[model samples]
Target chain A: MDIAISLPIKDETLLPKLTIGDKIRVNGELFLFRDQVHKKIAENDTDQLDSINFLGSGVYYCAPTPVKEGFLIGSFGPTSSYRMDKYTEYVLKLGFKVMIGKGYRSDDIALLCKKYNAIYVITYGGCGALLNQYVKEVKLLAYQNLGTEAMQRVLVKDFPGYVAIDTFGNKLWK
Target chain B: MRQISCELFSNTLKSLLFETQYFIPEDVLENIKECYINESDSISRDVLNNILQNAKLSAATKLPLCQDTGIPQIFLELGSYVYLNFNLEKTVKNVVNIVYNEEKLRSSCVSDPLIRKNNLHCYSLHVDIVDNESLKVSVLIRGGGSENMSKTEMLLPGTTADEIKNFIVDNVINMLPYTCAPVIVGVGIGGTFEQSSLLAKKALLRNIGQRNQEKFYSMLEDMIKQNVNLKGCGALGLGGRVSVLDVFIETKPTHIATLPVSIVLQCHSVRKASKVI
Candidate 1:
């Protein structure tokens, strides 16, 4: 059978139809962050959050290296999603439909994904150099105090990621 | 006697930092290329291609190969014959600051683990002095993905070599895809707990694809590589032929009652550089 699907599937009705081997290519603006940025967000530091409007988009747990000249970012790869489990529900509440990272998530976040129509995606963990090319432009968001963990607004095109956790609570790994 | 100025240390360190960021070490690059050629899965092969292209662009453009330019770690072998010149810590800090600001590398380091504020951007540096006139420094730009997967355990004295191998193989299997498979495994055995962990990290500083000098250790490395690849972790843990590029083990004699082992994984982007001055 042949089929085509449009991504950023905000509607929950479409989640259950996804299968294990299904490949998804998401097109949306992304927000980049890591441990420090997540901590700041949990602490209610909205100063950096103001720079980005992630109301209905995705957030990538990443700490990218910088480029030499005429480049926006460097070796931007996914960090472990398990570390962000504590903040997943909160970010989902703030209106992010997609969470992209690597590794598995906690049960709490899995449950929240079911409650709220959101999907968690996983990318190759160490493929940073390849992943950076997907980022079209990067705008600093907040948490300059957090260095690489600071939040930034990033534009992506056909960003490749797999649905690790779906809205219906289906885990690709488990 | 050679009198080394603080300025000299800072300059050399900065150059090493920049060079490591720009050029992927020849051996590591070669291993990844080999994986690309041997990879059976189409998707994995394509992913490896993308990774190779990224390395090319990073090197030619003089950009950091991967973001997480890692903590500013320096393994220094200071020469005893050299006369004092300047403070080592300050020189390292200066080089770190220059790299952080000038190169725009992400400031991944923080002041405290608990408070977790990005007050400092330099990662921790480990220094050691040896009896020599020329200082040898090895810089490793470790990425978070593989570092996070490190594990340690204190085994009973009765634990056999088979047990050690099983422990390592199990951990590698469990961390597949998560730690970015096709990893380089470094094992530190027989030292104290902390010493074992440090030895494991130091093992990562070895040239990629090189074997340990001890015949038994070298044979162990070969066994580990074969077993891990058989796990089907493949490229990026998607399932393929080459799950691990290399495995290196370093061991030292410990108390008869203790057998400590530490495992540190290095992803395909094994970025490291060394210089003796």
Candidate 2:
């Protein structure tokens, strides 16, 4: 069944309902943290990340471009998820219940998701312009100097995606 | 000798970069439309539909088709009879820097490959002075997704056609989910190791459905296409019969001792544009 899930879900309220291959529309605040942010967090320079409670939050592996005139954000879409797989365990261990990007994650990442009872969703990989429609607002939360790699909070509305890994550890990508 | 203005070169290259980077070419768009119609699975159809919608949205909003404008490579065929007033290389670099660094596009160039600094946008420039008087410039916007996921192998010179086909189809299937299928697969066979890789990358410039002139290679290309699609990686890796939009095979004579093959994957947004002066 198709599901519409709001982001920053608390505990496992909406996560367990998600199963691998389920097409879902997710909206609400998603923290845009990609490679650099993960590196900073690993380096212990938590900066603005520590102030936020990531428990049950969804992190998007996306980097933003310059906002065009009359738009809230640029063509911000999902990057390949595997590059960030190294940080998946760390992010999940820190209490993230949802993560989103494109393509398959490491098998270990799927197991970690099950261990944390979290879900991983896959969105259109390179369709940045179309994905931009779901983004309503954005705010920089940390690392503003990092250009597109900075951490930000983006509020999306009815963004379409698929559950790549469900809470039970079932995964879509083989 | 025909004299071409440096400003004309700079201007033409600038506009081509700006326009082609945003606009999905008609062939690619049409193929995507076909994929969308043919996609049987609901999820894969949604992904293809989103790609179609993205093309329209990109055209209307002036937003980039993809955020990673990718590494911009220029292939120039300079006519021997043509002369330029200024340094063509410097002008090309300047135009590329401006186009990629502009607000709409992402500055993806990691200047020092070892240092990994994204400051310098590398101009992968190739020049071939042709005998004709008409100068041509072509740009290939190689996205990181497909480029990074590509594979190159140096196989035994005795490798048979089936062996080559198996290697290609297998790798393309594995790369499909990651490289953002439905993609354009460019295969470079023969040539030296480096030349084979270059041939493969250049093969991506071939228009979709354009086949090799030789019957053997063209048939090999068709076979590779059928085999990869039969594996069914499909669009967005959602599982269907059209993962690969097209396969381009380019071959060159190589030393009898060594055989090289390169598989270059171009994502659905095969951003290629050209102009003749």
Candidate 3:
């Protein structure tokens, strides 16, 4: 079904409503993290990560261009999700129900999502300028030293995406 | 000898970087539109439409086309008779730092791969000295997604074009969705291991929708392009008829025992800008 749904961070009810191929409009807060942030969160002390209170939230695999003046944020979009597959179980276990990224997810990650009652969504790859319209605000949360790969908390309105993997293991790319 | 000031050069680089990141070249844009018209699959067509809209929005807003602003790559065709007032390498890096910060482009470079320390000021510059008196610089914003999918292979001297075709097909399939199709497949054949890869990247700098000057290589490009699209990798690799927008091949004579081939895949954005000064 071609339906648009709103998904807020720290919400669990939206996952069940999403199925493969359904267009989603994520309206709420999203935590932005990429390669370095993921590795840090998975390997380092969890204190910094725990402080964010991202449990039951959506984690967006992305990095933004520098935030320009008078704008909430810079052009922002999803990075490839497969690179984050190794760390999926860790974040999913942390109660992240919504994983937004781009490209296909590995079978293991899909299985993990099924086990954890989480879902994987895809934003159009390389559509950063268009996606930036949804960003309402941006805040640097932690790891400022990572520069671009640092963790960021962003508030988004009507953020467009598509469900690539459902909790039931149905994958749109497959 | 012609003298160029560092300030002029830096300003030019900055402009090129900003313009390329925000705007898709006209030829490339036109080719994508053509792909959109010819695409039959609904999903692929929708994906192409999104790409088109993304280009429009990027140009309209003066924002980056993708969040992966990419590592800035500058290819300099420096003339032997031309002289720069300052150290070229350091000058380019310094200019990149100012431009990236001033333009709010993302920093994707790291101080060390293992430690993963970010270097916001880093840029890669490749310098080639030519006989002419003009300096030409070509800039490409290579996203991590497609850049990571580049492949190089060394085959026996007798490796056939069919084998090369299979190799290209296999890599595209393996990199599906991840590499971001309708990709431009740049293939380099018959140089030393490293040169082959360099040629592959150089091939990407060529104008889109244009074939190699040599008829033999052009035919090979067409053959590979046809075979790849037949794989149904489609737009964004979501599945469709057009997996590739174009295929480019660059070649050089190699030693008798080596048939080195390198492939560099460029996503649909294909952000490139060049200037001859």
**Candidate 1 chain A: worst 10 consecutive residues by lDDT?**
A1-10
lDDT of 1 by residue, B1-277 (tens): 7777776777778888888776878888888898898887755676677678878877776566666677756788778787657777777887888887897777676677787666566655786777877878788777666778899999998997887888998888787767666678889998788889889988988877688998888988888878888877676666677778888899988888999999998877777888887
Give the clashing residue pairs of candidate 3, or none.
none
Across residues B191-217, which tens digit of lDDT does each residue of candidate 2 receive?
Answer: 988889888988988887899999999
User: Which predicted model would earn the best TM-score?
Assistant: 2
Task: Calculate model 3's interface RMSD in Å.
Answer: 1.3
What docking tier does model 2 reach?
A: medium
Instruction: Report the Cα interface RMSD of each model, rounded to 1 decimal.
Output: 2.7, 1.4, 1.3
User: DockQ, per-model, please?
Assistant: 0.49, 0.67, 0.71
Superposed Cα deviation of residue B263, candidate 2 (Å):
0.5
Candidate ordering by DockQ (highest first) = 3, 2, 1
lDDT at position B167, candidate 1: 91
In model 2, which runs have C-alpha deviations exceeding 4 angstroms? none
Give me the displacement of residue A121 in model 3, in angstroms. Answer: 0.8
Q: What stretches of model 3 exceed 4 Å from their correct place? A: A9-14
List model 3 lDDT by residue over A1-174, tens digit each. Answer: 355544454456657767877777787788898777777667855677765666668899988888777678888878988999887787777777889988877889778878988888887788898888888888899888778888889988878777788888888763
